[model samples]
Target: MSIPIDDLPDIPADLIDEIKAFLRLDHDEDDPAIAEMAGSASLLCESFTRQLLVARMAQDMLPVKNVWQKLSRLPVQAIDLVESVAADGLTQELSSDDYIVDIDSDGQGWIRLQTAVSVSRVRVSYAAGLVADWEEVPTMLRQGIVRMTGYFYANRDSNDVHQLPHAVSALWRPYRRMRMG
Candidate 1:
């Protein structure tokens, strides 16, 4: 499992303006609300694609199944720390010489231990994402997020809606990572 160690970045002001323009709004009264909706849209995009939209610190815990293990998030920028947690509640930080880290061409992260160790789980802290800033995010993703924000704003009163529009899903499908158990 992977846990975010930092809060998601706030929606950029330019994005809020773009969403407002897309909705053809003439007022700034709802800027804060729209920002919130945009944030939600970003989360939906991330969730649907199974990828982080911006750079951030994250921690992952994996069972010691073999000499190597895959980190949950992809496009890993760097591995900051790796620790082995023993069954008796002891933890040992692994040095650089103890393991090797690789991000494959597919953008998945892999860590391989150079030596054998008895442990129940491994804890990894790393940075992973597709882009470092909102402007660096893919154009399709930004467009989808804008449209989704409009959808959310327009349908705010409808409590029955539970899924993203087909267009949004279509825009994000190509970026979706296939997860396997």
Candidate 2:
């Protein structure tokens, strides 16, 4: 499994004024709550899409199976380490020449092994994401978060809320990573 090593996303709050405009509210009044909700929406969007909305370091402990293995996150910027884990779950550095990482913005890439080993664990440390900050997050994703925040805020009284709204989903769909069988 892969684990994010970054602190809470340095993702900036969505533009409160933009949200206010979308809601058709008077410009003079500010809904401070939208800032917090926007952050939540961004995190939720990241979680739902399994794509990091901001750039940061991450690690994954995966069993080295077959000659190819997918890295934990897509849009991987760099690979810091490739280690072997012992039966006791301890990590030790491995030579970089043993494998090659192929990554792309589409988030479809894998490590190609040069030689097989009996070790059951391989740990990968890498930096991956669309951008390093909220400002750099894709326009559609930022818009989606705003849309979601607005949806949640407007639907605060609704009892049955289970998924992201259609508009928000459409905006995020293109960025979502597709699984191949």
Candidate 3:
């Protein structure tokens, strides 16, 4: 499960302007609408890649089945707090000494506990993402987002927003995080 602690980052002004230029709009009348489309496009790319383009804080409720448990989010930047939640809704915060964070070869996040946990579940508040800033996002992802936004703008009057262009997927496919069952 994912619980976002803050609002997602907005599409940068420069990028918005770039999209407007792609749409060949010299006027700012539709700037807000364009920005919204850009934001949606960014999220679409992020979802397809299963990666967060910007750093974000989120909490995950995970089962305590072993000493080391994999976190739901990848590229975990930092662990803010870890607590065990009881059936009655009480929470016990774990100490730093109780567990350690580990990043596997695949960049997956894991938390190793010194001892096995008795709790059925734990809530971990963590920061995770691929880049710290929007500017740090890869060029391919940015271009994919721009293209998707342009597509959305072009099809605003129809049901075509549900359709994702092949080019956008091609650009973002390399960054997709493959999950195994």
Please name the candidate that would achieve the greatest lDDT relative to the true structure. 1
> Candidates sorted by lDDT, descending order?
1, 3, 2
Candidate 2 residue pairs in clash (backbone atoms < 3 Å) = none
Model 3 segments beyond 4 Å from truth? 116-118
TM-score of each: 0.90, 0.80, 0.91
How do the residues 1-181 of candidate 1 rate in per-residue lDDT, one tens digit apiece? 8878977898899999999999999899999999999999998888889888998888998776556688887678888998998887688998788788888887788988776668878888999889999999999999999999999999999997788799998888889998887
- Write down the lDDT of every candidate, Cα atoms only: 0.88, 0.77, 0.84
By TM-score, who's the top model here?
3
Which is better, 1 or 2, measured by lDDT?
Answer: 1
Model 1 RMSD in Å is 1.9
CA-only RMSD, every prediction: 1.9, 3.0, 1.7
Model 2, 114: alpha-carbon shift in Å? 2.6
Pick by lDDT: 1 or 3, better one: 1
State the displacement of the C-alpha of residue 78, model 1, in Å, after optimal TM-score superposition.
1.4
**Model 3, 1-181: lDDT tens per residue?**
6777756698789999888878898999888999999989988887898887898987888777557878877678888898888888799998888778787776677877665677888888888888998888899999898889999888889964666799999999999998889
